[model samples]
Each structure stands twice: as structure tokens, then as C-alpha cells.
Target: MGVGSSSQNSSAMVAIKSQEDQGSAPDLKPKKKICCACPETKKLRDECIVEHGESACEKWIEAHRKCLRAEGFNV
Candidate 1:
């Protein structure tokens, strides 16, 4: 019983470790690419590049809007 319990614990630990080792895991949805232009939207594009990796122009626009809002901008 002790051995069985230890084995089970070990397996669980392995599974947990594997999950952690996988890191955040890529999103199933396709990632978008950023235009890298558009000054009003480039801030978030640059930030996303630094944060969540490269993203699409649309995503950058969205991120820029969020960033601007967070920064107290009226955008």
C-alpha cells in the first residue's frame, strides 16, 4: 500500500511537472501580426512585442486602445 501510494504520488508529480514545463502553452487560436506602423497604435504594438510576443495590426489596435485607456487617454 505504501509503495502504491508513493507511485501514485510520483506519477501525479510527473504530470504536474510536465504541465508546468509546458509553460503558458500557445493559444489554439491563430496569433495575429502587427503592422508596425500607425503611430496612434504603435505603442501597444511595441508593448505586445515586449509582452505577449508579436501580434496582428488589429490586435495591436485593440491593445493600444486598452493601453491608452489605462494611461488615462481619451482614445
Candidate 2:
């Protein structure tokens, strides 16, 4: 039983290491379900666009995009 358990553990380790090497390890989610992610950036982006117009809000918009990408969102 002890030998069998060790073999299984090693197999699992090899699988994880393989995934890491391939850079295919499950890290980023397919999409974030929460609409509230990156609220601070979202707020700034929204307020800027509303007050100044979209063209003037590019900085805030890109900041929000960067924030969403950091939060595992596809944006």
C-alpha cells in the first residue's frame, strides 16, 4: 500500500511539472463572472468618459482594461 501511494504521488508530481513546463497549467480562468471586478478603475473610467467624453478618457479606459486583465478577465 505504501509503495502504491508513493507511485501515485510521483505520477501526480510529474503531471504538474509537465504542465508547468508547457505553460499550459490551468492558471487564468476562462472568464471572470463578477461584474464588480476592478471597481476602482471601472469607476474612474466611467466617470471620466461621462464627464469628459470617451476620447478624453482613453487613459482611464486603458487603465481599466489593464486592471481587468490582471483580474483574469478577457476584457
Candidate 3:
């Protein structure tokens, strides 16, 4: 009975530890990218555009704005 009780307790502890580990993991939401259209972000976006090109940065900014709007944020 003692061995059986100890095994059950260890299993419960393992389950609790697993739940805590999962809760502590970082959220999976997409990170905000540099907005090329905004004056404040223009410099950073320009550098990214220079390296990655105009089309890519423009697409990123547009997508980011759309995401903000979807989230009820007034971008």
C-alpha cells in the first residue's frame, strides 16, 4: 500500500509540473514587425527594406495594420 500510494503521489506531482511548464511557455502570437508607412518606424523599415526589399516590408506593414484593426486597436 505504501509503494502504491507513493507512485500515485509522484504521478500527481508529474502532472502538476507538466501543467506549470506549459503555462510558463511563451505565447504563440505573431510578433509586431516594423511598420514602413509610419514616420517613427521609417528608418528601421528603410533598413529592413534595403536588406529585404520594398515589397516585403510593405506587405509586412499592411498585414500588421490589418491585424491591429482585427484586434479592435485603432492603428
Candidate 4:
């Protein structure tokens, strides 16, 4: 009886471990983080990057960075 109970527990542990291994992480960071609360700022920054390129879009980028920072996001 003791051996049978131990076998059952081991099987249950294996099943639990398999489920954990197969589960996707919900807290994974995104590939890119757009400003959530500042759509206008994000759009302006995106347009600046498109029209002027990254090197020339410093001010627009900084503005968006500040906005994103204020909203508690790491730009």
C-alpha cells in the first residue's frame, strides 16, 4: 500500500511538472513597448523617425521618452 501511494504521488508530480513546462509565461516582456497612455506623443515620435530618421529625430524622441518615463515605462 505504501509503495502504491508513493507511485501515485510521483506520477502526480510528473504531471504537474509537465503542465508547468508547457505553460507560456504571461509576464514576458514585449518585443517593443509603445507608449500606452500617450498615443499622440508616440505617433509624433514615430512620424519623426520615419520622416527624418533616428539621428535627426532627437527632440521628438526625447519628448516621447519623457512622456513614457512620466507614465512609469522604461523607454
Candidate 5:
């Protein structure tokens, strides 16, 4: 009985693992290409960083990240 129960549990675990393996990750394949994902925010972020440096461009950088996240990118 014990061995049979263990075998059933192992099979259940394998089934669960198989489902997880087949599941698609939401952020794995973005709907849009990276370069085209967030053009407006990217432009603002890039220009800000170039003109004022990274530290000064935090707002724009965060904005770009947010935009990318909206577009299904992990950022």
C-alpha cells in the first residue's frame, strides 16, 4: 500500500512538472521587438541620459521601464 501511494504521488508530481514545463512565460517573448517596444519613452530616456547623465535621468529611465512593462517586456 505504501509503495503504491508513493508511486501515485510521484506520477502526480511528474504530471504537475510537465504542465509547468509546457506553460509559456508571459515575459519570455515580448509582443513587440525590443527596439520598437517603447519608442517614445525610449527617446525621452535616451536624450535625458545623454544630456544630463544617468543620475539625472532617473524619471525618464523609470518611465521607459514602466512603458516596457506595459508592452509585456520584463524590462
Candidate 6:
């Protein structure tokens, strides 16, 4: 049992080392989710565009664009 466990540990170490060499370590970082990224501007867009008219909501549209850009979005 001890020998088997040692080889298992060695295999695990090999896997981890290979991943490090390939730069494939697990990533736990959070990425920007578009829906949850910007709330205030999203709500503004929803109210202005969905509830009202597009032409009437130009300012809100621009506001949302600026907000998204601030949040690392291309828009």
C-alpha cells in the first residue's frame, strides 16, 4: 500500500509539473460578466430604451456605452 501510494503521489507531482511547464495551472480568478458588470447604466438603458423610445434615449445610450467601456467592454 505504501509503495502504491508513493507512485500515485509521484504521478500527481508529474501532472502538476507538466501543467506548470505548459502554463496550464487552474485559474480561479473572476472574469467580467456583462450582465452583472454595470448595473446603474444597464438599468438606465432598460428604462430609457425598453420603456421609452430609442431616439429619446440617446443620452442614456451614450451613458451606457461609457459605462460598458469603463467596465472593459469594447463598446
Candidate achieving the largest TM-score: 5
Error of 6 at 65 (Å): 0.7
In the range 1-75, model 1's lDDT, one tens digit per residue, is 776999999999999999888778643331333332245667656766776766445677686766555444545
What TM-score do all the candidates reach, one by one?
A: 0.32, 0.61, 0.31, 0.50, 0.64, 0.53
lDDT of 1 at 24: 83
User: Tens digit of lDDT per residue, candidate 4, span 1-75?
Assistant: 687999999999999998898686344343445535678888888898999899998888888878766665666
Residue 14 of model 4, lDDT score = 100
Q: Note the residue pairs that clash in candidate 5.
A: none
TM-score of candidate 2 on Cα atoms, chains taken together: 0.61
- Tell me how candidate 3 scores on lDDT: 0.64
Candidate ranking under TM-score, highest first, comes to: 5, 2, 6, 4, 1, 3
Listed per model in order, the count of residue pairs whose N, CA or C atoms clash below 3 Å is 5, 0, 0, 0, 0, 0
Off by over 4 Å in 6: 1-30
Clashes of 1: 5
lDDT of 1 at 48: 65
Q: Per the 3 Å backbone cut-off, how many clashing residue pairs does candidate 2 have?
A: 0
Model 3 regions lying over 4 Å from their true place: 26-75
Runs in model 4 deviating more than 4 A are 1-35
Compare candidates 2 and 6 on lDDT and give the better one. 2
Looking at model 4, report the run of 10 residues with the lowest lDDT sum. 26-35
Better of 2 and 4 by lDDT: 2
Give the clash total for candidate 3: 0
Better of 1 and 6 by TM-score: 6
Q: How accurate is candidate 1 locally (lDDT)?
A: 0.62
Q: Model 5, poorest ten-residue lDDT window?
A: 22-31
